[model samples]
Target: MDATDGRLEAATVRARVATRENIARMNRSERAASALWPVPLAFGLAAILVARVTAVIDSRDALGIRGEFLIRDPDTALQLASVVASGMLVFLGIVFSTTLVAIQLAGSQYSPRAVRIFLRLRLTKVALGVFVATFVFAVAVLGEIRTKSGSDFTPTASLTVLVLLMVATVVTFLVFASGTARLLRIQYLVERIADEARPVFRDAFTRAQEVQADRPAPATATRVCTNRSPGVLDAVDVADLADAAAAAEGWIDVVAPVGGYVATGAPLAVVHGGGGGGGGDDRDGDQDVAIRRCFLLSNERTMLEDPAFGLRQLVDVAIRGLSPAVNDPTTAVQVIDRITDLLGGIADRPDPPEWYVDAAGTARVRMRGDTFDDLLRLGYVEIIRYGAGAPQVVRRLHAAFGSLSALGDARHHASIAAMGALLDAAVADAMPAPFSDLSGHPDPRGLG
Candidate 1:
């Protein structure tokens, strides 16, 4: 009995650790910065190795003839390599400056959260890495050129490699320029955010299906756990929460929903079955710690785990377009189209489950899951509210609802009809007598 109890305790600890690590990975800055470090380190190491190998080869008189290679004279080779290194360093500086400016522009013009899309681009990281690597390799090779016995000795292989790197640097620069230009466009930004959000929606849908099949009875609250700090509830490791709850012979109902700002001392979750031990007992304390470990709180919202974050970003863009200063109804309409595409993808899928169960067939965790109605409201209602005064905006919104209603799914139709009705009432109240007729039906072209 002692050994069995020890093994169970060890397993619980492991589960808790894994849950914490998973939460840490949801941080965008941490993930992007991690990708940046490895590039410079790997390239710096490669530079040293290439320099050493070329020096060894040069010592053995490996070059058949000095003039056979493009760079013949040792002095000229060193001079040219140094120039290339300087140019690459300057180019790298320019790239970093331009990228910073672009990030600033994106943050100011679009939603600040949209900046992560640029930060996470693999192409930009690789471009930065290639230029830095070339510069390092050129400098290393330049250091190895030597003079001995009235003869100049140059490493032909090293110079050749440097020339290739220079060519690669140029190619990468052009590609990076084009990519940066594309990133600035609103269409690309909307599509990219939507693409990233699709998987999150699918995962939530899958989990819901699993929970629905083996639905367990909700447990009555035995204890409530309060948070220690204030932040947005970004994500929760539900599986790990279930593991910990099972170990405590109980279940946890997560009180704070994802994307919600939680304050310190507020009930984050309620433990459902542990014998009323409050916070003092060792077993109860362990359960409290385990439950807290599963909740990932952050100062800002992230798309990694919050299914609604992407929709929020799209809404931000649309609302910004409709602002009085901007007065760009077409931009708002474009955003609605993208939102329509995303909603259409998940329209027919079943809603995610609110409860999580353990291997023992006991319900262990209760979470807030995404529903079609919730998504529809998040994606469209705000835009409708803000753009109600603009006929074009109102018309485009009606068209979006019509498109979704056309799907023929009863669940989707119900939400779409309700939103359309609300939009019609808003337009009637906001638009003047002359334009009230525009709200009669969804015109795909928005009064054009």
Candidate 2:
């Protein structure tokens, strides 16, 4: 019974690993970097396998130059391999422990989401993978010396490769450390988050088109509720949903906003007009399955296509910097610089298409996105409210709003103006009279 259960567990693990659908957003390459084991595990297996194959060549008498290199004695060769393997294992333990300490300190000092920056670094992952591979290869080589034709075989080529891997791992560790140190700094952390969304905001920018606002879902509308896997609505494939609805001769409104929390059995979307004989219902559960597949939910939101997440993280850092305990207004000021540039770039873009339509010009899908006002609010609301007491923060907000009003289309002026009013009021109410008056003037330097 125990053996059967173990086999079943093993089979389940394999199936989960092989199936992409089990985890949403697995198609994204960045997602792979977050997992610590997979890369290192693959490297370890490949390294050992390469060493084993090379051993076969080393054993061949036809290769006249094989045994004429490195240690000829099996015991000395085994000892060297053992030492390298053990040393590498110890080295990996120390490196990861130090990394966790860094991550912990960064999270406490900055925002919690800052930890993802470290985990998502492929450089660190690759370096760790090389370390693991070096260790595994050495160990595997050591085993060959002990078990295979004892005292007779010494795979010199395999040992040389192991030594090379060790040297490479050492170099990789230095690079990883330097990169990690840079990422830990507040300026780098916020800028990176801001940079990830620059292209998103720029590319998605567009002139406001004829947006067909969402109509209320009728009582008769078919509600599409989520199945067991509950998480944040990270992303929705708008094109696919539009296509599915068009095919079904129906309309879909994804009620839950991307980046919002979704509970199990909660409404994922509402469908109107379809499925008596349409919308993939030729088979049971087809329409629902199609609808569910278009949504990629996970424990947290990703910036894959969501530009607002960038604003979200930046605002978080700025707000934390404003907190009394971490009252580092300079960090808040730096954050505003990024917010201004990001919003400025977005201000130049035309409005995105609000409605996803089919060939016949019918509205097939309705979903919400952050407008300039929305982005402005998400990026600045808290900063203004919290930073009001600080003249530097208030001054920066004044400048940011002024820049946006100047750089963006006339349509964005109203929103920018409203935010400016809020900033004006916040400073007037929070700061001393003279400082409040001075802070109102646009100063990109926040103090200047």
Instruction: Point to the candidate with the largest lDDT.
Output: 1
Query: Which pairs of residues have clashing backbones in candidate 1?
Result: none
Q: List TM-score per model, in order.
A: 0.87, 0.84
lDDT tens readout by residue for model 1, 1-448: 1245345222121011112237766665545553555666677677778778877776675765445687777888888888998998898898888788888988878778788888777777888888888888888887777755576777787887788988999999999999988988988888888888888777665533252223333356478888877998878887788888777777677898888888987888887776543564334476777788888887777765677988998889888888888787777887888888888777776676566666655566777767889999999888888888888778878888887877646767877889988888888888997787856667776767
* Count of residue pairs whose backbone atoms collide, per candidate: 0, 4
Model 1, residue 335: distance off in Å is 0.8
lDDT of 2: 0.75
Pairing residues by index, what is the TM-score of model 2? Answer: 0.84
Model 1 spans with C-alpha error above 4 angstroms? 1-21, 24-30, 33-38, 53-67, 148-151, 207-221, 276-284
Give the lDDT of residue 172 in candidate 1.
93
The regions of model 2 sitting more than 4 angstroms off are: 1-30, 61-63, 67-73, 146-152, 206-228, 275-286, 359-361
